[model samples]
Target: MSKISTLQVEKVNTHIVNWLITYAENAKVNGFVVGISGGVDSAVTSTLCAQTGLSTLCVEMPIHQAPSHVSRGREHIEQLKKRFPNVTNVEADLTTIFDGFKTIVPIVSDSDKVNLSLANTRARLRMATLYYFAGIHGLLVAGTGNKVEDFGVGFYTKYGDGGVDLSPIADLMKSDVYALGKYLQIPNSILEASPTDGLFGDDRTDEDQLGASYDELEWAMLEEEKGKISENFSGREKTVFDIYKKLNTINQHKMNEIPVCIVSNDIK
Candidate 1:
């Protein structure tokens, strides 16, 4: 059962398509360039971009990505191409680049730290790849982050997946994204697959990393918005609420703007 309410699928779809088209026209860009991760967010975002009748480039930057993720991503892209003439795709197998980066970086004693850092590195590498295509093609990099990940828990890596010219679905919850994905007629392979960032080069899911399900997190976010505290809950609800609060607190760095030092006039 989803904690988020059902969306008006057709109206939401039309609104997002129009928004993407308007943003692109104002920015004077050719279209949107989305990183397809074989997840619901990317599927919906790329589909929305495609509906604008603008050139939507779905770039697959796989850095030791799992086989399932790759296949699902390709499936969605192929379906998109067949459905929309404005859609195109390119796969940049970044496994070699990622390995080369590890060889050059200094060896660290902490295996855990190194593993996490490398995972984020994979995302940063993909970000650079997306910008590369965006630069040459005059397209804006469309972010695939949803509301629960982007605002609720800040699950994205800083300046990695977090870096984007515009976000088409950041305002929608994970369930909302799934709803949009269904209405967009995305591949069942993607619609049914467990949500994973595919940054860690393994099958560990987003729930495994977050220690909570998207539905639980969504409920926690709503409670927090209502000024509820952990003291008000008990059992698993309290545990999940605490998890959400802790992540929301720690990831404020990613959610907020980069801090700038304001030089006082007297200092000069």
Candidate 2:
């Protein structure tokens, strides 16, 4: 059972849609731009943006994307267009762009390092693509990140997925996002689909990379937030908490704002 209620879900949906509309209007921009990755977060976010009746651009920037994932994204956009006239779906295939980047870049032997670097590059490339459209048209890049990924473990790449003018769902947990997705009537295929970064060339789910399910992570986050870490926690809980802490510590850089060095005026 969900910890959140139906009314809470509706409230969040209304709040997000209103915020998107107000933010875009106050900024005097044409609209909001989002990159659709066929994940629940993106689907829900883009849908909410479309509900605002703004000229929302949903771009699918696939870099060696899985065909199933691509189809899911395209289908979601098609459905959105049928419902929302302000929605526009565009495809920016970045496979060749990525290949061109890899050609001139220095090579590394460490498999993990190489993969991590390439994944981040894919995210930044997608960021650039969103901004490219946002720049040409006066629009702000809307981020598709949830609370757990955005603040708990900093799962997003800095200045990549994290680089955005606005994040409508940053306050929502993964489960909350799911609830909102259902409330927003996002496609069932996307809600049932395992969330992925789509940065890896292969079919690795987010849980495969994170070492624990979103449920486990969310539980750990709740416990940590409540300052309720206890010795009586089950083995599974302990393990999840340990992993969560390690990730949080390692990725704090991504969550925190950039530090500036203030020059002292006093002469030494």
Runs off by more than 4 Å, candidate 2: 1-7, 230-232
Error of 1 at 64 (Å): 1.2
Question: What does candidate 1 score on TM?
Answer: 0.98
- TM-score, per-candidate, Cα-based: 0.98, 0.96
For model 2, give the 10-residue run with minimal summed lDDT: 1-10
In model 1, the clashing pairs are none
Top-scoring candidate (TM-score): 1
Give the poorly placed runs of model 1, Cα more than 4 Å off: none
In TM-score terms, candidate 2 sits at: 0.96
Please give the distance, in angstroms, between residue 24's alpha carbon in candidate 2 and its true position after superposition: 1.1
Clashing residue pairs for model 2: none
Model 2 over residues 23-140: C-alpha lDDT tens digits? 8889999888999998998898899999999999999998999998988998899999999999998889999999999999999889899899999999999998999999998999
What would the per-residue lDDT of candidate 1 be over residues 1-268, giving only the tens digit for each residue?
2575589989999999999999999999999999999888999999999999999999999887788998899999999999999999999989999999999999789999999999999999999999999999999999999998999999999989999999989999888888888888999888888888988878899999999999999999989999999999999999999999999999999999889999999997
